[model samples]
Target: MLVTGCAGFIGFHTARRLLTEGYQVIGYDNLNDYYDQTLKQDRLHLLTTNPSFHFVKGSLENIELLQHLFTTYKPKIVLHLAAQAGVRYSIENPHAYVQSNITGFMHLIECCQLFNVQHLLYASSSSVYGGNDKIPFCTTDRVDQPISVYAATKRSNELFAYTYSHLHHLRATGLRFFTVYGPWGRPDMALYTFANSILKDEPISLYNNGKMERDFTYIDDVVESIYRLMKKGHLQTRNTLHEIHNIGSNSPVQIEYIVQLIERELNKKAHKRYTPIQPGDVKRTYANLQTLIQAIQYQPTTSIEEGVRHFITWYKQYHNILD
Candidate 1:
């Protein structure tokens, strides 16, 4: 099993779960200071303690390195989760998206073809839904339009997966993840940032004046969904060689509600500042889980309250912040 971005939020959890389930996992991550490399290193630490885990520190941008890893390991299942992730950051550095998401993804998939990798499970984003006002975004909906460069690059990944699946018969599954949050999450995410700032008496930026809503999927649910899909793809006959599904909480919550939850968990009143919605950001993102439900019988069970509390607990402990 090859898990790219193993130091990242989703990838870390996914790799850990797979390792616990008795799989020899190859964990690859650039350990970029996108947020804090210490957090990434810590996540990698947990996995490295296991004898079956092998860690590689490198970027997906290096095609030769990716090709060499693919050839050497020849991973049967490549979980491509590494990417320059951030909607706001994409606005500032469009070239980074093109390099990491577009160019890096192409090299990764080409290596998959060369290695004859059986199943390719890569990460897509709910942001691909773009500016559609439709409630609970559906996988069947057309995604020709993208509001952000980050989203555009993810959509491109799906297209690449489809082409690869069609041409090479590589079983590819592109998971469109909704707003995922939990322990060990990226610091830039709303939940973490809000909690961190609130705990430190720093003002929290409420975008769209706290009107934005998101389907905040928990990390455990996401990992379980990924594990099930990977196992099924590995075991089952090639009935569906090319497929896409939305991995989300399946429950939409307002931005204010999440803030309230975090504030309550930390027992601190947030210093909130209302702000205009940033470009390349959607006002709302809700997932239609009918497709995911039917495919894997998967349903996200974590509530906002429980997820928030769990995250707060971990955050305080990780940072050694006493209430």
Candidate 2:
């Protein structure tokens, strides 16, 4: 199996789980300094100790390196999770999104087609539900109205996957993940950033005057869904190869409420500055998990409080913050 972005938050967990299941994983990551490099390196170090794991450091833009990897590993399954991840980051560096998410994905699909990879599971984002007023965003929703470049790129991935699947008979599955949070979560994510700010006695920025909302799906639930989807992909009929499913908590939480939860867990109060909604930021995101539930019998077990507590616990331990 080949796992791109294996050092990333979700990718790391997915690779670790597969390795634990006795599968040989070829982990690929560029270790970009999007956030803290130490965190990425730490995740990679944990995977490197495993005998079943081999790590490769390179960007998706490197087609030659990608081809070399595909030819060398000849992996039967490819999990494509690497991308220019953040929505706001995409605005500042739109070309990064194009180079990594679009061009890089093209290179990857080419390798998959040439190598005849059995299954290609790629990451999509709930932000693809941009400008969607409907609660509980569903797979059937028309995602033609993306407000951010990152979301646009993700939506393009689904379309490109379907086209490739139809033309080449490639078995491709796209999972549209919603605001994932957990212990080893990304620093840029809402949970981590809010916690960091609150802990440091810094004012946390509240957009939309604290009226925003997000479907905060926990990491375990997201990972479990991926695992089941991979297993289910084998028996699935070819007709369903070009399918997209929403992976989220189903229940949406208000942004202000999430801040309170983080404060409670951290035993601190946050100084917040409420402001209008930022450009490229959506007002709300709620996932309609019927498709996921029907496919994998997925039931999110973690609540916002539980997830926040676990993250703060890990955050304190990671930063060596002692009271």
Candidate 3:
């Protein structure tokens, strides 16, 4: 199995789970300075301890390198998770999104097709349901409108994956992930930023006057869902091979409530500054996980409180904070 972005938060957890299941996992990551390179390195260090894991430090944009790796590994399964992730960052650096999400993803799909990969699983975002006032975003819902470049790129990835699956008979699965958070999460994410700011008695910015809500899925649950789906792979019914599912908690929690939870966990008050919604920001995100549940029996059991507590525990340990 080949796992892209293996040093990332979701990729790391997924790779670790695959290793435990006795799969020979080959990890590919650029280790970019998007957030903190040390965090990526930490994940790589942990994975390298397992004999079944092999690490390759490179970017997906390197088409030659990607093709070489694919040819060398000849992996049966491909998990493509690497991309320029932040919605707001996409506004500042739109070209990065194009280069990585669009161009790099095209190369990856080509490699998957060339290698005759049995199944290809790639990450999409709930942000694809942008400007849709729907409560629980479903796969059947229209996702033609996207607010951010990041969302647009993810939606494009799904389209490309579908095309490849239909034309080349390659089994492809695209996972629309909601706001996933937990230990070893990206520092730029709201939960991690809020936790760090609250710990340091710094002010945390609240966008959209703190009215935004997100389906914050825990890392463990997200990884469990992926692991189960990996085993299931691409279902073969008749001819066409394609599947897409939303992996989320199916419960949207208010942003303010999440801040309050962080405060409670850290035993510190947050200094919040309410502001208007930023560009490329969505009002809310709620995932309709019925398809995932029906297909892979994926039911996220972690509540916001439990997930936050677990994250705080790890944060404290990682930062060497004495309670």
Candidate 4:
């Protein structure tokens, strides 16, 4: 099995889970300074402790490296999770998204097709819904309108995967992940940023006057969904070679409520700064997990409070905070 972005948050956890399941995982990542290179290296260090795990430091844009990976390892299953991931960042650095999510994704799928990869699971985002007024986002919903560059790139990946599946008969699955958060989460994400700000007594910005809501899926649930899909995704019979599913908690919580939870966890009050919503950000995201539940016989069960507690605990330990 080959896992890209093994140094990343979701990629790291997924790679760890796969390694624990007795799979020899060839971990690939560029270890970019997107947020913090130290965090990425720490995650890689943990994965390297596993004898079954092999590390490769390279970017998805390097087709030569990716081709070498596919040619040498001959991974039967390809999990493509490496992408420039930031909605707000995309507004400033659209070129980065185009290069990594578009060009790099093209290289990945091409290698998968050439290598005869049995199953290819890649990440998509709920942002593809694009300010949709619908209650819960579904896979069947029309996602042609993506508001942000990040969302557009994810949608493009789905289309590219579909084209490859049609042309090369490559078994492909696109996972539309919601706001996944937990221990080892990205610092750019709300949970981690909020925690950091609160701990430092800095005012945390609350966009849209804290009116936003999100379906915050836990990391463990996301990993479980991906693993189930990888193991049984081949059995899913469809007219086309491509399939897409929404992996989310199916429960949307308000931004203010999450902040309150974090404050409660740390026993610290936060200085809140109410502001307008940033560009390329959605107001709310709710995922309809009926498709995922039917396919995997499971849905995300971690509640907001529980997930927040887990993240805070990990955060304190990681930062060496004395309680």
Candidate 5:
């Protein structure tokens, strides 16, 4: 098994899960300074402790390195979770998205084709839905419009994977993840940022006057879905080699409710500053899980309250906060 971006939040958890399942994992990551490098290192450190996990410090942009890794391991399944992630950051660094998400993704698919990988499971984002007023977005919904470069790249990945599946019969699955959060979450995300600001008595920016809703899928649920899908392979799909599904909690919670949950967990009041919604920011995301349930026979089950509490506990321990 080859897991790209193994140092990242989702990638780390996914790699750990695979290692625990007794799979020898080839973990690849660039360890970029997109967030805190220390956090990435800490995640990598835990994975490296397992004898089944082999870490490779490299970027997907380097086709030669990817080709070398593919030739060496000849991984049967490629779990592609690597990308220049962040919606707002893509605006400031559009070229980075082009290089990493677009160019890097192309290199990856080419290698997967040449290496004859059995299955390629890659991460997509709900951002591909754009600012649609539609509730409970479905897989069949039109995704011709993407607000951010990050989203466009993700949608492009789906298209590219579809092309490969059609042309070369490369079995691939694209998981369109909703707002995934929980323990060891990204610092740039609302949950982590809000908790940190509240702890420091700093004001947390409330975009769109905090009038937003999100399908906050838990990390564990996301991993479980990926594992099941990977293990099941193309058994469920009778006709096509390419498939796409929305992995989400199927429950949209208001932004205010999330803050309240965090405040309750931390026993602190948040300082809020209402602000206009940032560019590429969506008003809401709700997943229609009918398709995912049919495929995996399951959906994300972690409730917002429980997920928030778990995250707070991990956050406190990680930051050495005593209270």
Candidate 6:
């Protein structure tokens, strides 16, 4: 099994789970400074302790390196998760998104085809359902419009994967993840940022007057879904092996409510600054997880409060914060 972005939050958790399941896991990560390198290194350190796990540090854009890794490992299953993430950051550096998400992703798919991978699963985002006021975004919904370059690249990935599946007989699955959060989450994400701000008694930025809603799926749930999907692989349809599933909690929570939950978990009140919605930001994201449920019997069991508490516990321990 090969997992890209293995040093990242979702990638780390998935790799650890695979290792525990007794699979020989090869992790690839660039260890970029998009977030804290220390955190990425910490996750990598934990994985290296497991004998079943091996890691390679390199960017996905490095086509030669990616092909070399694929040729050497000959992994049957490839989980492509590495990308230049963050919708807001895409506005500041659009070229990075194209390089990592577009060019890098193409390299991954090409290698998957060359290696004859049994299954290729890549991460997509709910952000692809841009400007759609629909309550719960479904897989069947048309996603032709993307508000951010980051989302556009993800959508492009799906298209490219489809082409590969149709032409090369590659089994491919694109998972449209909602707002996933838990321990060791990304710093730029709202949950982490809110927790850090509340802990420091600093003002937290509330976009769109805190009217945004997100389907905050727990990390464990997301990893479990991925594991199950990986095991099941992809089914052929119309002579093409391609599938798209939305992995989310199927329940959306308001941004303000999440802030309140964090405050309650920390026994404190947050200093908040309500502001207009930023560019490349969406107002709401609700996922229709019926496909995942019907296909794999998957259901997210963690509530927002419980998930937030778990994250808070980890945050305190990881940061050595004493109340």
Local distance difference test scores for all models: 0.90, 0.92, 0.92, 0.93, 0.93, 0.92
| Residues 60-166 of candidate 1: C-alpha lDDT, one tens digit per residue | 88988888887788788889999999999999999999999999899899999989998899999999999987787999999989999999999999999989888
Pairs in steric clash, model 6: none
Model 3 score (lDDT)? 0.92
- State the displacement of the C-alpha of residue 106, model 2, in Å, after optimal TM-score superposition: 0.4
Weakest 10 consecutive residues, lDDT, candidate 6? 231-240
Q: In model 3, how large is the Cα lDDT of residue 270?
A: 99
Worst window of 10 by summed lDDT in candidate 3 = 231-240
Models, CA RMSD each: 1.1, 0.8, 0.9, 0.8, 0.9, 1.1
lDDT of 6 by residue, 1-323 (tens): 99999999999999999999999999999999998999999999999999999899999989999889988889999999999999989989999999999999999999999888999999999999998877799999999999999999999999999999889989998999999999999998999999889888899999999898899999999999998888777454555478899989989999999999999988999999999999988898999988888778878889999999999999999999887
Task: Tell me the tens digit of each residue's lDDT in model 4 across 116-157.
Answer: 999999999999999888788889998988999999999999
Candidate 3 clash pair list: none
For model 3, what is the alpha-carbon lDDT of residue 286? 92
Residue 268 lDDT, candidate 1, scale 0-100: 83
Residue 133's lDDT within candidate 4 is: 80
TM-score each candidate: 0.98, 0.98, 0.98, 0.99, 0.99, 0.98
Better of 1 and 2 by lDDT: 2
User: lDDT for model 2, on a 0 to 1 scale?
Assistant: 0.92
Over all chains combined, what TM-score does candidate 3 have?
A: 0.98
